[model samples]
Target: RAFARSEVWDLLESCHLRCNPLGDAGVAELARGRQRRFLRHLDIAHSDVTDDGLTELSKSDRFPGLQSLEVGYGYSVRSPNAGPAFGPDGIAALLTTEQWALKRLHVSVVSDTPLAGRFEELRSRFADRLTIQQIGTDPHR
Candidate 1:
């Protein structure tokens, strides 16, 4: 809910936006030009964003300047086949030149159900540049 765009707000050179219950506000702000310039690194840890929200955000061309992105994880309400994954499908919209500037990404998720497939997709898209750290109680097939 803190999406204000002003010179005062622009002074934020380095910011680490983390929220356990990060809503659409940050996503909406990023979609806008609020954090367009000064925000080089962003951390959206502990955010409960679903595939739908991630898909919407990935489609945006605003984060071209982003150098690093860190996505945290929690429980999800994903389907069985897809198994609540947040892999390449979610990030597919960003794998192009629009997100080519990203030097690194750090994701911590419990990839069970279909989440593993999503994770695998991400590894494929990112090629050797991806490092995944999956921690879940479910077995991996």
Candidate 2:
């Protein structure tokens, strides 16, 4: 609920935004930014974002200056709606976007999901600029 307000998006001077349990609605608001030019670090871990949200974030115009993206698990408590926030396809989509300035990505891959198998590929695709880290468990399949 912390990152749901449009006022937060209006603060263009802010460089870092961190929140958990935000779900898709909060992410949608964040991704809907038309003037958030200064946002650099975005941490929305332990939320309910899916591939759609990830796709929006990967857009060339969205978060053009964003340097770090932290998603997936970071909390001890899990939501009933929680699931694989994004997978290899999401990462691949992000990599294809030419306008992103991302340097680091923090993720939590559920140990049992197919995404776990794609970590190496993600690393290879991003080379040394993008760092993806697993932070917790995988909820949905």
lDDT of each: 0.58, 0.60
Itemize residue pairs with steric clashes in candidate 2: 83-140, 110-138
Tens digit of lDDT per residue, candidate 1, span 1-141? 454344464655455666556655556555565556555666775576555556666666655566666665655555334333245555555455354445466676665434556668767778755556667657655
Query: Could you tell me how far off, in angstroms, the CA of residue 32 lies in candidate 1 after the best superposition?
Result: 1.8
Q: In candidate 2, how many Å is residue 50 off?
A: 1.6
What's the TM-score of each model vs. the native?
Answer: 0.67, 0.68
The window of 10 residues in a row where model 1 has the poorest summed lDDT is 77-86
Kindly report which residue stretches of model 2 are placed more than 4 angstroms away from their true locations once superposed: 1-19, 74-83, 101-103, 110-115, 135-141
Error of 2 at 55 (Å): 0.9
TM-score of 1: 0.67
Summed backbone clashes in each candidate are 4, 2
**Candidate 1 error regions (>4 Å):** 4-9, 76-87, 97-103, 110-114, 137-141
